[model samples]
Target: MAECLAIRSALSSALDLGIQFLSLKTDCQVLAKAISSKRTVVEVHGVISDIFFCISQLKGFTCSFILRAANVEVDTLAKAALASYLVIF
Candidate 1:
């Protein structure tokens, strides 16, 4: 759910910035697969719906999964945000 919200928020920001192309990378394989398939399990259907809606606004977009080790920067930021009880963009 957090992954979906992050992706949706990022996409919304990109759209607001008039970005026509985007390549989103994440460490969550399940989320990546769900986004690529344009479907989600019932548990997160609402969030995925929002994600897909944001995706549809993009001219070009790609979502990919990277190993957690390769995403250390984001992981660190996420941990920091959690520690601070705040949300990271």
Candidate 2:
């Protein structure tokens, strides 16, 4: 669920900024697969729907899953934000 929200927020920002192309990277394999398949479990169907809608609006979009070690910087930042109870994009 957190992964879904984060991706949605990023996509929303890109749309707001008039970005025509986007490459999204995630360390969560399930989330990446869900997005690629355009399907979500019942618990997060709404959020996934929103993500799909955003993808439809984009001229080009790519969502990829990377190993945790490959995304250490973002992983650290996310942890820091959680520790501080802050929202990050």
Candidate 3:
């Protein structure tokens, strides 16, 4: 979740620098569903709520849910990170 927030903030900052159209893609089904629903964010992720709200400000952005097989890079990286985290602590 923290990583998602950081990426969203960076993307927003980039978009601020004269972007015409932007589309966000995420493998997280929950996040994609939540944003597409255009409903208020729940308090569960209160710390990251601001970042989610910031996503609403982007123009022509669409959030999508992709299957694991279709998201090899992200899925691989997530698993690698999980493995590394476990190894570290």
Candidate number that wins on lDDT, 1 or 3: 1
How much is the lDDT of residue 28 in candidate 2?
87
In candidate 2, residue 24 scores what lDDT? 84
Q: If the candidates were sorted by their TM-score against the true structure, best first, what order would they fall in? A: 1, 2, 3
Each prediction's RMSD over C-alphas, in Å, is: 3.1, 3.2, 4.5
Residue pair clashes in candidate 3:
none
Against the true structure, whose lDDT is highest? 2
Q: What is the C-alpha lDDT of each candidate?
A: 0.78, 0.81, 0.61
Residue-level lDDT tens digits of model 3 in 1-89? 53355445555676678664566566777767766775544643653465566665666666678876787777666566556556777
Q: Give candidate 3 misplaced runs (Cα > 4 Å).
A: 40-44, 76-89
Clashes of 1: 0
Model 3: lDDT of residue 21: 56
How would you encode candidate 2's per-residue C-alpha lDDT over 10-58 as one tens digit per residue? Answer: 7899999999899989898988888888787687899889999999999
Instruction: Give me the runs in candidate 2 sitting further than 4 Å from their true place.
Output: 76-89
**Span of ten consecutive residues with least summed lDDT in model 2:** 80-89
Model 2 clash number: 0
Candidate 1 lDDT, 21-46, residue by residue in tens: 99988998988888888877687798
